[model samples]
Target: MTGLLVHSARLITANSPGDIRDDPTGWVRIRDGIVTATGTMEGWAPDGDEVVDASQIGGPGAIITSGLVDIHNHGGATFAFDGSIEEILQAVDAHAAHGVTRIVLSLVSAPPRALEAQLTRIAAARGEQPGILGAHLEGPYIDSDRCGAHDPAALHPPEAHELARLLATGVVQQVTLAPELTGGIEAVRQIVAAGSVAAIGHTGADAGTTLRAIDAGASLLTHTFNAMPPVHHRVPGPIGAAAADDRMILEIIADGSHVDRTIVRMLFAAAPGRVALVSDAMAAAAASDGEYLLGAQKVTVRDGLATLHGTSVLAGSTLTLDRALRNVVSWGIPLGAAIASATVVPARAIQRDDLGRLEVGCRGDLVIWDSALVPRAVWRDGVRIVADAVAHNRPLAAG
Candidate 1:
């Protein structure tokens, strides 16, 4: 890869608490798809390759942060997870423009045959799309009573053979199930043993069952507080279990409607660095409000509220990670904490140590945003993918 230089950036390193550093006259050097050096303008000058003027691109308010990582998202830009390769790529491109550099394609509840076909297709597309990290299976093993927005008829207990087949496709990275279901805790162990993340969600699992799953290697809570039982004084649910366990990562949909701002603040305070903000968004995101398909179900999105055609249950979110970040910040969360939820927390949840930070030896995926926290430019693997001067004035994407 060729080398490039980024100068005059307000750097927010999502490394530690209070690590926001502003060097109005600073610069970063990129070589071989890694950040080689960073420092102030005093002794910094482009020597080997391109010397791009970042201020000219993004103006004075250019803020540089790690590329956003979304470990769970069903679809975006009118593309559902069950679509063909071309449609998936189009969805990914739409999300890339919004600064989502890495994403795990989440699949809702479906039959074994349909699930297998989708996984096989996604596995085939893996090499062609670098941002397509892996697949998240969020179905086939959940509570029938709490299966909000999911086809309850498709719910079933985890079968080792079925899971083996999905894992054999080499595209299943994360699977969400209810621990209280038949064979659910054992399924968590099986998923972990297969080298994929196991998560608990869409269930009526009580605190005891939830913790047991965590002990059995279920490391994530899929969209906490949405489909699971609410936390009650007498009966603390999965949300409480996740909050109490430091090893578990909780996924929060911060679209302001799925969760309340006060609860968001509480979760940030309770979980600190373990919360990952996700856009559990469906096909309507980044597209106009209308009818969209998620798996076999039909959803209607009106005024940004997505719901199943005949039910009051929230279908999914219309949120993007940038909007989630903004909402968290608006809820009085510290900028660093909110940013970490969208970056480091999700990266760590997926066991990707090389992403979610702006530092030496890390993948050169990044986002440059203006003062309003709007994405100006995006980079993936040192390649420039999206650069909108009027929208995202920054130059270059990644390589």
Candidate 2:
């Protein structure tokens, strides 16, 4: 197998807090789709079949980090997750072009039979691309009043039989629910028992009930402060409970529309490493803004803001992870924290250790960005998938 070496770039390892090792001259070696070694340029010896001098491509401030991971996304490229396999693949490609290499296909609230079909199709889609992590069911068992883009007519109280059926597919990595519903706490327990993450989302659950759900094994808060109640000093809600708990990982949209810039900074301060930046993006992401469908709801997207056809409620977002990364950084977040929130943080939120870090034995998936933080090249499994003209011409092969 051909070994590849990438040298002369800032590396955000994301293995731990304050772990950014390489500032402007570092190297990483990949063999057979796995990172075999990484270090400063001084320790590097040129012994690879393929070599890339990142500095030549992205100038003096080139940055290389593990490929961004999106844990929650409906679809992109004018395709919804409930669409056919071809549409799903197209959506995945659109996000990948924007530096999201690993993604959990999110589905909105729908009937049991429909959801089962979607899950099964997503499982098949995962087979087509190694980047498709799995499926994330974001509804059906959530609060109707809090169902942002999910169909209110499809909302249902959590039931053991239905939950068991969905988890039985073994392809579901996470399930978001309103823990305040009947049997909701037990549902959290059941999801955990089935090796699936139970996420508290789309709910009117008070802080007390939200904490109870967390204790019952709910470890993720989906799209924090969006579908749930706000934090009131007298009546704290799920966002407040999640912020106080170290075990909970809060998912933030970071699109500047779904979440305010100040609140985005505050969540990072409150939860620190617990904040997972996700693009709760719908079909309009990476495409022109117009009318779109989110599950059964009619959505109209105007100037990149998506809302219900006739109302002001946000349906989803026309956001990509790369933009989310830049948004947080522009909002005064530390560079390391912003990168981790887009990469390792979301990977850990879904319990994926093989992704989100450029460590030895991790997948050789990374993004090379110019000084402006825009991705100039993307690599997945040791193969460059997307690259600009400069990146294509800058590979300095060393024998």
Candidate 3:
């Protein structure tokens, strides 16, 4: 485990530092927990304490890339992130097997006290759990009319005192709130000032309001096209504004049911590397179909698509990042572009440069995939998390 050589891969290289692309037959070397070197076998040899033959597992279709970074996730394995610390890491482990090596745990809107508890606990555990990047406060500051799957009663406008308490916890990485509400732009300003990425979501904003929020430092759009108003010829909502602004990063579900493949392609064409493929995944991500709760509202999962129990309002998703990569590729995007969406794009969105790359001095977190892009192995911080990727791909026990 001291040093390992992983070569003969579809070596994914960053096209120009941040624009990631793929080249056939890639190789990487890991010394300790840092990426020591990476390149193809033009004039080199494969030698290490333990040599991993990528071709031995999947013939000529072996693809290796930086592990997917999920900047938005609720929970998986039927365990909600709002639970205790033990449950949170368990849920993260479930997604880890599917190539989601890092995560920003997202919490749905809740009461002020409950949110404070969640934030404090997560902040305290941030350093202890390397997989957890931070907590995303998908808030009580949303537009009630568009509160998809969130309890309307729990949804409220932003307050200075509440924002102060949450920010003081020091674990807030991003906050998703409706920008059309009263003081919405000001809230965006506050969030950005406190060093957290402000995001616009569940809003009834027109293009003008969306632009103002962007001007006010709102740099991200959460789960585009689901809770917000749809694009129109006259009243283009946040989606149009995001498309217009190159600085804004948009998050897409890419579960095929939440957004159509045609729209996904259009989004890629519209934004290029600005799209951060996020799994706004819920409790049933890697588990069997059953009853789950996305925040206080009950959710039902039948055939891996989660929604409000009696209604058609889609509640998060049961998708993993690897599946998202596959879904995007199915939409005809190049493999490099798709990988960028899942890796560097999301890392840049969160401003974590240390992740989502295979360069020297970067953390040795990478995923080895088979011919179809399904993960066959996963490593985090130079440590193997999944002993056998094929075994984890099987149907997991329902939590």
* RMSD after CA superposition, every candidate: 4.2, 5.3, 2.9
> Could you say which candidate leads in lDDT?
2
lDDT of 3 by residue, 275-310 (tens): 889889999888888898998899998878888999
**Candidate 2 error regions (>4 Å):** 17-22, 389-399
Q: Give the residue spans of candidate 3 off by over 4 A.
A: 15-18, 42-49, 391-399
Which order, best to worst by lDDT?
2, 3, 1
Error of 3 at 110 (Å): 0.4
Best by TM-score: 2
Off by over 4 Å in 1: 16-25, 41-43, 389-399
Report lDDT per candidate.
Answer: 0.83, 0.87, 0.84
Please give the lDDT score for candidate 1. Answer: 0.83
What tens digits encode model 2's per-residue C-alpha lDDT throughout 147-166?
Answer: 88788899999999989999
lDDT of 3 at 300: 90
**lDDT over C-alpha atoms for residue 371 of model 3:** 85
